[model samples]
Target: MRRRRLRALLGAALTAAIAVPLVAVAGDASAATNSFRGVNWADARDNYVNGWVIPSGLTAADSYSTVYTKANGIIAGFQSLLGANTVRLPINPQSVNDTWWASYKGAFDSALAHGMKVIVSYWEADTAKDGYVDDPAAWNTMWDRVTTDYAGNANVYFEPMNEPFGYSLSAWVSLCSTWLSRHANIPRGRVLISGTGYNDNVTGVGAASALSGTLLSLHFYGFWASDTTRAAWTTNLSNRLGSYSSRTVIDEAGSPMTTGLTYTGAANQDGNVFTSYFAATTDLTRARQMGIVYWPGLRTGDTYSITRQSGSGLAVNNASGVAQLRWGWGL
Candidate 1:
């Protein structure tokens, strides 16, 4: 087994320079025009056990081609069931090399054809350095190729990297700066920046001038949270995500869907913790007219995935989970 499970944790391009608190990015008109209900398409090259073990039976032949082909149906389900307009996919460094870019474009094309905005981020499942931006050369190469591929596609968004916890806050922001200047051809509004730390908080980056103009992204899981009350959830939101909701998106928020997603005051594997958290988050996103994307739209052993399917066809697994997503998305 590749132990891909260990790394289980873990937008935009376009036009003008828009001003945000400490950051002023050009062409970030998204602050006024962006709003979406989205989901993450898990299982990129990041592996587990031996090689890449996705929902083992979710596709035919288990090849990269199959994976991308299947993604079409998976994404369609998200649109039909959750009313999702966005789908974030993680790409491994290898996938972006010249050898694989063409293959990966299938998933990208499938998403865009459905009118789904695509947000792609690079991740090193087995990084030599856990918290630092590992494999700088590979990371840059991946972004360079991907940015070039979708440079002007409004539906495609570029997220330089995901969960950049290895670098210090200052170091990370510096990296963001370098990324902006290096890929200047891509507009600021089309990009998305991970917050400080494991993307658990965004207050610092959201306030940094260098990071302005781009949208902000954050991740949430039950393990990352302790607060089970709505009030606490609200306070936490106000502190971490409140400042930039207009240009922020919760690209990864989730909980176990095995129990079927019903949430009530009474505690259950499907209740209290995740329910309260999403409740507050949904309320905030709606109030601020922000974007929201749930984590693991589909992943094996990850109870958080909202859709349950086998071999890439439409086999809806968790109506409870989907229902909550609908509620969160205001469907």
Candidate 2:
């Protein structure tokens, strides 16, 4: 997730960008887009750290074997309780090049072993959280190493970066083009180009023919709007998607699941801020058959977390949230 302060500035840029529409290139999107029924497993400090990142409930002290064991259990909970078939995780240059990667790969291996599609996304470090890549050399090195490691793994997908809000559309597109050309070994279908700003809109990237074969990642939040009805929210989302729904995956859409808000029924959703947003977004996902991944499936201290750690096990924080999520997946 991106910081709200950043959103305040970038949101205006997004509005201006939207004022001038990009022509959507009409083509068939891979059916794989809808096949992802997933959730993000985020770090407690929000995945942007000064050094190595440790996912919530995981310690840097853990060995490879321990990470594998813990990740397996958490993944099992996602499958049995929420019916998730995919998981999105964060990575940074520091985490990838350091020794922690040896142990972190255990989590990916465990998830894949359990038949989960893993999306490993890059997150900028907090020391320079200006929404741009911290270091071009380090960033490219991280991707080179990561792509080399997972080139042969069909279950593992690579997302260039998470919420790249600093670069202009042309500059961001140029970076993505460079990335695609550099790592030609990985299949384009396995690469996800994030939306223009804060991963908020896909129309710009969708129009780029160079990025045609790749999937698009989008993020939405209830706090971004005050639409009272499902229809209004749907319009807001559709405007951003702009004929790219077939190829787009809502990789990060969430609300407060642990706040005792009901997620079912029109009466419960209509006037309420959180419920209305979720209802409209999920309803649209089901309609479009687009892939939708809820934000922070398990993040310590996050009220939006759908699952919580119970002793050594994992449990649902809100049954209704899971129900609505599954409904979006058409489960």
Highest TM-score model number:
2
| Model 1 ranges with Cα > 4 A deviation | 1-34, 44-68, 264-271, 310-312
Residue 219's lDDT within candidate 2 is: 87
Can you write out model 1's per-residue Cα lDDT over 1-331, one digit (the tens) per residue? 1243234333001001122334434433356323567887766333311222233223324345665677677777778777789988767666566454565566777788889999887665563527555568877887888888789898888887777766666777889999999999988888889876566666666777787788888765554456777667777777666456667777877766776556532253223777777666666666667677887676655666666665555455666666656666666
- Summarize candidate 2's per-residue lDDT along 1-331 as a digit string, tens digits: 4464346345536645643333455684576477999999989888888788888778899999999989988999889999999999999989999999999988889899999999999998877877799998999999999988889999999999988888788778889999999999988989999988888888888887778789999888887777788888888889888878888999998889888998987788888778989999999999899999898899998899999987665899999989999998988
RMSD of each: 6.1, 1.8
Instruction: Pick the lDDT winner.
Output: 2
True lDDT of residue 134, candidate 1: 57
Local accuracy by lDDT, each model: 0.66, 0.86
TM-score of every model versus the real structure: 0.82, 0.96
Local error of candidate 1 at residue 275 (angstroms): 2.4
